[model samples]
Target: MDTSLLFWNNIISTCGVPRIITSDRDPKFTSELWTNLYDMLGTKIPFSMAYHPQKDGLSERMIQTMGISLGDHLNKNLLSIHPTAKDVHDMWKKACEKDAKCIAEAKEYNKQRWDKSHKEPDSKEGDQVLVSILNFNNLKGPKKMRDSFLGHFTIIKLIGKNEVEVRLTKDFSRKHPVFPVILIKPYFQTEEYRFPSSKKNPTAPEIVEVEDSPGPVKRIIKASKIRLNGKDQRQYLVRFKNQTADKDKLLAEDAIPDANLHLRRFRASRRTE
Candidate 1:
């Protein structure tokens, strides 16, 4: 795509220059060319987390409505074996207009919904904050094993109404420091906060891996252990019934579903046998 021409024709020529632009971290938008273009235009480009389109709620909602409109249009028209060009054009026009209206209504609905759960958060410069790690942590595993947020970052600046520029306390490798306010929460300092790890379960249950099939495999969880990694994410040590000698799998908490339920069932089955 011609970034300059498209920027000029679609954005600049129509609505004039924008102060800031938010977008997904797609390669096209994050490429050097677009970066330079936005820089030249003096537009701050804050990228959403990669693969997390929900971060761009407005655009994602519009796209969802457009998809539904396309499905509706196809259902109503695809059965017809033949149609004239004008007929097709009219049918598409009607569908487009319908989708556009739905999008407008949905936008208003979303704004109301957001207002219910979201208020303008207040943070001054240099305040410590915890940013929700929803978009950043995409690791597949049990919900219990995942971290809900990351940070305790130092706020550098408050941008507009609902965004902030932050500096990482531990890692400086991140390219962009700006993040949305929704993902950020205030971090209160307290003298009572302890740095020590919480007490571990005195009797950790043995966890076994069940084979992924209809047929029963005599797998039992012998033990489970959790530890924190470099990213401060929890990893699990799972030992299964009849596991190979001195061998256990290191997995994420999400790797096992309902560990307690599995263990209970296994014990119950053994009693019956």
Candidate 2:
């Protein structure tokens, strides 16, 4: 809150008080002190919806263009030269035009690339869809091995042109229910049997208690010290018995009590080297 107030004060000092203030639903922008100060100044504060940027698209684009122009100027060492007010204005005008043209071209290129693999979403309210897992972090297992999409969530309602309110499961309770159309895909049910003519009763495989009786450590590939929760801890890259190199896992020292013998052997071998 203090930083936001200080920033706004600096902006106001240089540009005078703005009649209207637009911001996102950030905690600092929505704080009581911020609201009270703006209210006293008679400046209307309009907040854009969460996770949506289209509301301030124009301003964002302009800022991006200006940043690109400034970066270009700096890279070319053009800022070192002194120029008249008119010269400065002309240079800025030209830079803005050039940046705008480049931005348009980039946008068109992205649209074409996106269109090749994606189509307009036709999902409606109550339709079951799979939400993209790109933004989620609470999921278990290795990221590369995890499913790219998760759900069977139903669309509750359409928020606007491209956003929708989804009825997500309790697992996603912490996440916002709303998401853009690009992050959702229609869910399709898998067929029980692709080849119906083949009459074969599939037998269920026996469930192994791998966690209860984990395989013995075949060898300790390597060891490393890492900082965990502000403390230094040792970890081992272990390959287990009967498992291939690909099945190797990184484990804390205490995680495999039986691996103490292996750990000692590894340390002794390293000392000899």
Against the true structure, whose TM-score is highest? 2
Q: Against the correct fold, how does model 2 do in TM-score?
A: 0.32
Give the alpha carbon lDDT tens digit for every residue of 1-273 in model 2: 565477567876789776655566788778886777676677767676545656775665666689998887654445555435338788899999999999999999999999999787788888989999978978999889998899999999998779999998998888998998988888866543434676568899988875552477888989989999999999999988898888888889888657779888999989999
Q: What is the alpha-carbon lDDT of model 1 when measured against the actual structure?
A: 0.69
> In candidate 1, residue 247 scores what lDDT?
56
Off by over 4 Å in 2: 1-116, 191-273
Alpha-carbon RMSD to native, per candidate: 24.0, 20.5
Q: Provide the overall lDDT of each model, using Cα atoms, as 2-decimal numbers.
A: 0.69, 0.81
Q: Can you give the lDDT of residue 242 in candidate 2?
A: 92
Per-candidate TM-scores read 0.29, 0.32
39, model 2: CA deviation in Å? 27
Candidate 1 local lDDT, 1-273, one digit each (tens) = 377767878877889877656666778778976777777767766766634665576776676799998887665455464556448778899999999999999999999999999776888898999887666644467878777877688998989988999997545445468888888888867633443365455797889997552222234444444544644554444555555635555555456556566567756866888
Error of 1 at 173 (Å): 2.8
Q: Cα lDDT for residue 131, model 2?
A: 93
